[model samples]
Target: MSDLLRLATAGDVDDGKSTLVGRLLYDTKSVLADQLDAVTADSALSTPDLALLVDGLRSEREQGITIDVAYRYFATPRRSFVLADTPGHVQYTRNTVTGASTAQLAILLVDARKGIRGQTRRHAAVLALLGVRHLVLAVNKIDLVGYDESTFTVMAKQFAAHAAGLGYPRDAVTAIPISALRGDNVVDRGGRTSWYTGPTLLEHLESVHTAPDPDQTPLRFPVQYVIRPRSAGCPDYRGYAGQVAAGVVRCGDEVAVLPSGLRTTVAGIDTPDGRLVEAPAGQSVTLLLEHDLDVSRGDMITAADAPPALTDEFDATLCWLGDRPLRRGTRLLVKHGTRTIPAIAQELLVRLDEQALSLCGQPGELVLNDIGLVRLRTAEHVPIDDYDTSRATGSFIVIDPADGSTLAAGLVGADLPIQ
Candidate 1:
């Protein structure tokens, strides 16, 4: 199997995010001939409109803006890619958060002429808060600015400082000057940016470590479904089915079920491909335990030595995506992994000021697209780990009780009360 890398792009509107994505696809010859023909026929200009490759929505073409997160998949000789083209409008910040939540690396675009804007800063802060450790500040549209080295230098320093202030390590952040429109430093190094001698955007993406190896993390497998075969051919078959959230598990490994504090040994690990000696994170498999201890969907199975905390109340940080303001005592359903439990917005904590990167004095409620620290109380005990420890077990979403609309994306222990 080929190595896969997941990444997302974020920046302010008109920062050429869609165009950059289009250029990557076009330059890499990932676009089909018919798709290119359609774009060419649709374009009013002499040249084909590359943005049309990704801006698939008719509304997007009509308005000339990206409103939803568009995902594209392609591969090169070295690696395969799953790229998310996120919207840049401040109103669509929720989309940006959704796109970057699972991204191992993010390419944050900035208009070479406009340095880092408020929305850029907000996106950067959100990426860092979501635990994305690798960042590429792609300073795009260099052609419009005369390809000046000083321009790139100044903007690079400013963004580096902002990323550092937001708690991102300087070494983890890379600033690349490019013109996504002209394809400079995107797929190849163009002559215009001779002064900027750095790896191209593609180079950094191919080389950056996606995330900590799953085998190095603790085991966290949230049981999704219980499998029990009643047929006479396998009358006694009982297994727990789910995707391994983190770490590795093997037959005969001692495991513990969370919330119930029951312990069992792994009797077997099975898949359609047949029995497996071991399974790693991201693999979907069924596990048979030595003793059935009432395991069900939503219960977590973890290595005995490193079980997650089972708690009903904890402080969490959330990116409020609800239309209605989120105030204290708001009741909702918290969906963690495969488990859905009644929960209440126990308290309204501090809200993060995107510009200042500081907490605003206690707010009575969080409005749309507001990133705030809040306390949540669940109806039953749920197993969880800190967002930093394991993204799989540490993140959750709040659903509106009345309509089931997703309201917020939450990270456990994202923000602790000021000391």
Candidate 2:
């Protein structure tokens, strides 16, 4: 199987994110004949509206703006891709977080004519906070600027400086000049950018190494379901089923059940294909314990020597998504992995001035699309890792109890004082 690459596109509104995504699909021949025909018929110009390949919503098509996250799947002979085309509107910034949270890389577009804007900085800051390590500063619409190398050079330098100020390593960022509409350097090199010698966008996407080896991290397995078979074939079957959040699990490895602090050994690891001696991260398998001592859903099975910290309260950075403002003492549901617990917004610590990459004075409340640091108090102790350590165990969502609407996305330990 070809290695899978998960990436997301982000930028200010009308910066050609959707066009870039559509161009990638079209140039790769991922779009069907019927879809291309429909897009061509809908185009105002003689050429087909490539953006229609990704902007599937009627509202998006009519407004010519993407409102929600649109995911596209395509594969090359060398690699497979899961691309998230996120909205560029400030109000829809929360959707960008949703799209980028799982991505290993982010492609941040900047219009060659307009240069870097406030929204561009805002999106970059959010991506950095979400722990996106690899960044591509795509200086798009180069054709509009007469494909000038100097224009690309200036914009690329400014973005690199800003990204460095946000704590991203200089080597972690790559700047490319492209025209998503004209298909320059997106999939096939249009050869207009002869002055630039960097690899094409598709080349970088195919070759970049982003996947972390599972064996290097500590184990984190949150039990999603406790399987108790009642069938005659397996009357005494008791298995814990969940995707390994991190690290590896072997048949005889010692494990600890979190919050309960019970120790056990893995008796067997079973998958739909049958029993296995071990399993790694990203695999969903059932584990049989040597001694069952009351394990349930929401409980975590971790490496005995490297268990996550259990805490009832912790500081977190939040991206407020609710229409209503987030204030102190507001009750909400904190959904971390498979566990949902009642939690209170204890205090609003500080708000991020995204443009400046600094903190604003402590805010009394966080309004819609606000990024801020807040302290939360949960009703029970929850196992959590630092956001920088493990994305799966350190992230959570704040949901409204009344209507079940998601209010915020939280990253644990994101608010730690800069050292």
Candidate 3:
């Protein structure tokens, strides 16, 4: 396994995303002594509110709200971390979506005094929708609540009830009562709490198993580049260059290239040095086919034994993130796997009211951060598995054509009906 795990920190404004991140880094000794002194000095100059060092934005620094994503890197002996500090404001929900798109785990901060607010509910619902497996509800600012165990228990239970209703596993979340300002229950267990003796926030991150399942479905290789030999020694060579997306491709495995249903046998797996015995997901290499085949970009190579659903029109759950509300006839760019194609939003469906966690009436235009189902017809047939089945290949982003900004993100083939 690679030594890095991607994690995103999210919450409403002033929920301690920056301070929690700062505390995690500081307690793990990831920050330097000189930097600590500088932060200390900065804290002294401020109005005793310079706790959020991860708020790198000057505007956020002045306004005391996280406006952009701040990334911090730290590690323990067992695991390494790349924490994406996403914005808490409702306007920046698109940024949060981008940050959490690749995250295996999310560290969602909540104010201990306030418990779960509307923003907290919204962020949690978003993370759950995005398929984030693990959730660490850092009940920050515990010092403000007198480090009360009853307060922590009540908050955890309240949030747990809602999260369980969302179909998240009972044990998927681990709540840690912490005070990012006082450095309690973050790295070292807070001294004031004898009632709580669980792992610290840093400890949980260092020990969680947050990797995707090994490609157990079908072998998929999206052909990115075609390599043709130019020498007399190797005259007849047709190779497809790209990383494997899922399953495993062996030297003699029968494979079918998508969008054409052309069958071919893998002759060899080629690397810069030489041939590889096999290739799996994340291995960037070239495939030499036993027979000459016409392959190019936007073409997917799948296992002959098992194939993905080849369809032109499909339903998907989308989170609209564009400033200009989505209207009918809005042609956009759809990126699936390594394929980019022209697509048009066919329907508005319904706008999800996140504050109430339910669907409202029909919406003509999908505003910012509205999660709903959308119908998109592509220019060509694309092979996509269910998002619940294959997240790597079933998810796509919709980009606006006029201004060239990403408008929404979607997950295909979900069984749960759009609410």
TM-score, ranked from best to worst: 1, 2, 3
Q: Would you list the clashing residue pairs of candidate 3? A: none
For all the candidates, what are their Cα RMSDs to the real structure? Answer: 2.2, 2.1, 3.1
For residues 1-419, could you state the per-residue lDDT of candidate 1 as single tens digits? 35899999999998999999999999888999999999999987899989888899999999899999999998888789999999999889889999999898999999998888999988988898897788899999999999989999999999888888887777899999999988999999989888878899988777776655545678889999998887889888889999999888999999999879899999999999999999998999999999969989999999998899999999899999999999999999999999999999989878988777778867999998888999999999999999978888899999999999999999999852221
Q: Give the clash count for each candidate.
A: 0, 0, 0
| Top model number, lDDT | 2
Superposition error at 162 for model 3 (Å): 1.6
Candidate 3, residue 350: the lDDT equals 62
lDDT for each residue of candidate 2 in 296-344, tens digit (9 for 90 to 100): 9999999999999999999999989999999999999999988999999
lDDT of each: 0.90, 0.91, 0.81
Which is the winner by lDDT between candidate 1 and candidate 3? 1
RMSD of 2: 2.1
